[model samples]
Target chain A: METGTAAHDDAAREPVWTGLPPGLLKMRRLLLVVWLGLLTVVLGALLNLFAGPAWAAFALLPLALIVWGWVLLGRNWRSWRYAERADDLLISRGVLWHHETIVPYGRMQLVEVTSGPVERHFGLASVQLHTAAAATDATIPGLVPAEAERLRDRLTELGEARSAGL
Target chain B: MTTPGAEKDVPEAAEVVREQVPVVERRLHPVTPLRRAWAPVAVIIGWAVHDPNQAQEQLTRLTTITLLIGLAVFVPAAGLYGFLTWWFTHFSVTDTELRIRTGLLFRRTAHIRLERIQAVDVTQPLLARVAGVAKLKLDVVGTDKKDELAFLGEGEARALRAELLARAAGFAPETVHDVGEAPSQQLLHVPAGVLAVSLVLTGATWGSLAAALVVPPLLWLATHSVWTVLATALPLLGAAGASSVGRFVGEYDWTLGESPDGLRIDHGLLDRTHETVPPGRVQTVRIVEPLLWRRRGWVRVELDVAGSSNSVLVPVAPREIAESVVARVLPGVTVPPLPALSRPPRRAHWCVPLWWRGYGLAVTDTVFAARHGLLRRSLALVPHAKVQSVRLKQGPWERFWRLAEVHVDTGANGTVTARLRDAEEAAELLREQAERSRTGRRDARPDRWMA
Candidate 1:
């Protein structure tokens, strides 16, 4: 089928939305803070090598404290979101620069529902949809367990109906 | 389009039905006895060889230290393995789908519907054969993903094969014929002349034999003592004997069988490998004759397939047989007729590089070769679907005449390269072939073709 044909008008009209689980963002920020802290400590040590002992001593405490603060704030700053429209599932999130990906349901090949230990404890889950084409795939994270299951069923049904020449 | 308000076009309200459907069956793969013993063996060996005097060591009483360390590492590892065995050893085949769930920490479950499966190839490695198990590789069309459901009992493999074929037949009426039926007939078999020619052209057969005889003497000379010769030569002799046995077993036991489902090739001596390729999934077919094999009239048949990208199916047979087999598997995909065979223009003497010439240059060369067809010299170049890229190559000498060769890469399995000695001609040919491949339909459509 020609992808540009009028038959795909419905897909073009769909709005995109996405939401990531809070735990995932928290996990990412925790990693970033730890990395930043390590960088600061390494930089302080390198500066100690070049500067006089007094300068090294003066820099170490403040650098360590700043790193610690970053680590503390990172744990609290995690979050994500999603929205579904007529034709696409839009996912948006990032600590630094936000990214938005729109995935069309018709392109979906497989839908997977997964739960991690934290998600399990919180009764939450994530749904990932794979596409035949490498690009244009998306995952929606941080849904309530029941919502994730419902979405999985709906996506699977929609994928199958579309594949069957709907 | 029908009128919006027509009785047939009236929208019907969705009906609601309440039913209790069973949850999808969960399955875990069975743990092999060898795998279960591997960790314990490694732990015991490590404990026996561990040296405490190294800089990394902790000072402690050896017996107590070993016991504590072993318990700390082995206990959790064994327990985790046991848990994994329980969790991932299961698999389930429902009425309409197959599901494989695996992984310990991040559990992964893959599901494939019966209707989507294009072919199922049952492969048995050495361990699988000894364990009475086989791996089912299901290739589904319209998707690039490959799902491997392993450790099926040999009996289960057969049952699954029949069930899958039956389901396929139900969806596609053309496949209603018994899958067990043999193919119409094999178009070619390795002819004796071809075998002789292959043995001469490629010195591998004789070289192997020569190596077998020379290794013992070579070892004996190296050791310089009659008593030590036995120690040195015995291993070499054993290895050579084993290799010869392997070769013999492979040559004699090799069978290429044809069935309605696909072409089945089974070979190997101690560790047999069985591979099947349904015509539908074969992306491309190539007939190649290496320079050395030219005089012997031997050609290698290779097929590109979806699931077996890492492996190429090469059947060495007579040139004529190779042509016939290619025609049967892929019709109307071979190069057009040529006049006669001639010695390839002297490679060293050609004034301008001919390798880069367009179709016209190739035609001229083919026409020259056609005059001497009985000499057994000819080259056929066939391009496959979708020429995605074209590359031109030339060595330093050819660069003198602004000459370059062309190689066209297609989406198909095998590499389709053409050598044109003339750069301008090669460019023109590349353009023509690329355009033709883009517009033409594939020679064999997967949906209809069957072995």
Candidate 2:
């Protein structure tokens, strides 16, 4: 077959998208704010050492990125949503320049559920699905540990069933 | 990160056979074990060579006696360590899974489900070949961790590989031996002479060889021909040459064929390697034709399997043969028709690095093919069912020029991102590819057995 029909033109309704946990917005802001604060402080001290108050204004660059990041963090978190369809998992993320990733059940070889020390402090975890492809940037972060485990189990079950079934 | 520690129920007949086999515990080859003693022997020789005149003049009774005592203690200790290692690492094959248990202190066990097994590769290193042993490497689908039984008797390795394949393919135990020798049709063969010549012709391989040869002179210049430099450079020279030879061993006499088990590959001249890539194990197929090989119409076929990033099926073969192999592996994927388009009004071609080189991409009935590369031409086929995600990338320059790139990411393998001069066309390709992938996965029977 050389050519096939375009498949998305017939969709009647927008795909139902589920946004990320609101707690992630707070986590991201906290991390970015701390990081930016440390960077600005370090740069501020270095500026003081090198050129004094003449370069104090240059510290504003990090502040700008931090402020920009703070605002975009919420938007990015808001933009993060996953749609669990019948056969594939769709993860839409990013703001300004949007990205949507679809991982089919049959393509999944492993479902990993992990929680770092920071995420654990927030009682949040992430679920990562590994396919045959090397780089898998399709992870659903900021989910509750219980929810993450449940998703991991469900995806694993679906992966096994679909892969063997295929 | 997680291990499949639990065992599932296996067929009763198979279970009985597993118990009868009595859990085989095998050791690695003795070459590594013998290395333990040889290392000290080398050190002793090196020590004496350091100051022969001084050593002879200063050959005090205490020092000579100390040397004797040191050798006596070190040799036994190294032997003990080697024996413990050989005793500890062992793997057993049961009906439902292959279990590997290793470690002398902290016990670690890995259980691989039979259904998840992909391919079994039988390889023998030059050293191992002299000892009449082979390594059976099991490649499981979807995981990087490879299960290997190293340095086994040739017959045992063959038997184990057949049994593993039989278990993986859901075949009865009684028929595994018969299936191992299933009639296979030869597809392509590269004579050893051709392989050697090609190695020298490939710029990358030749570059490495030249670099390896140049190092000794470089070191001579740096060290002024010192003995210490000889010791260090000798290994570097030995290693580089050894690796080049190893590559030759692995790829020489390459033969690709098809059999009942799946794709059968037999390569290597001195150390023969017999590998079986079971049907449906391949994740992605790439047909690469280097600049030098283009005139000869030779293409290299590589597969991105669950096992390796670039598992080459054929290093160099006629284009027609390579095409047939690709067609067989990926039943219904094809190259796009000629006269490729450069979208976003040809004016935007300024954003692309090489506008005159041309771009080749097409959305086929069941797959997306992107064929573009200046010096090294390649055709990447991503079936709609195998598409992991579709991404549209527009850099600031591309945006100004009204162009974008559509990155078609297939799992594990690299992305086939086509930089098109048209943004709308890129978006359309993304939407269409994602949609096709969605619908294809929905309708396609993903089960291997069903196929």
- Best candidate according to lDDT: 2
Model 2, C-alpha of B73: deviation from truth (Å): 3.5
TM-score: model 2 vs. ground truth: 0.76
lDDT score, candidate 1, position A32: 56
Q: Which digits, one per residue and each the tens of the lDDT, describe model 1 over residues B1-451?
A: 1112323222241111101234345442364433443666677567655853552354344577787898799777776676565556556655446676666677777777755554566767777788887767776644333357565677767666665555443432223324433343443444444444454565455556676578657867677678676765566566655444544444434456666656666655556655555554554455555667766566666665543532334446766666666655544544334332122334423533443222222332111101112223334344333233334455555555555555544333334444424556655654444334333333434443432
Colliding pairs, model 2: A132-B411, A132-B412, A133-B411, A133-B412, A134-B412, A165-B447, A166-B446, A166-B447, A166-B448
Error of 1 at A27 (Å): 39
Q: Model 2: per-residue lDDT, tens digit, B170-249? A: 66544545656557898888887777766666777766667667877888888787886677667766666665676777
- Candidate 2 positional error at B244, Å: 6.3
Ten-residue stretch with the least lDDT total in model 1 chain B = B365-374
Model 1, A1-166: lDDT tens per residue?
2245365445434434344445554554555566666766776787778885556665556556666666554543342455554433545444333333444445456789999886676566888876533333366766777788888887777656544110
Docking class of 1: incorrect
List ranges where model 2 is wrong by over 4 Å.
A1-13, A17-86, A95-98, A108-129, A140-166, B1-62, B87-90, B141-146, B177-180, B206-246, B333-348, B355-358, B411-413, B438-451
* Candidate 2: true contacts recovered, fraction: 0.43
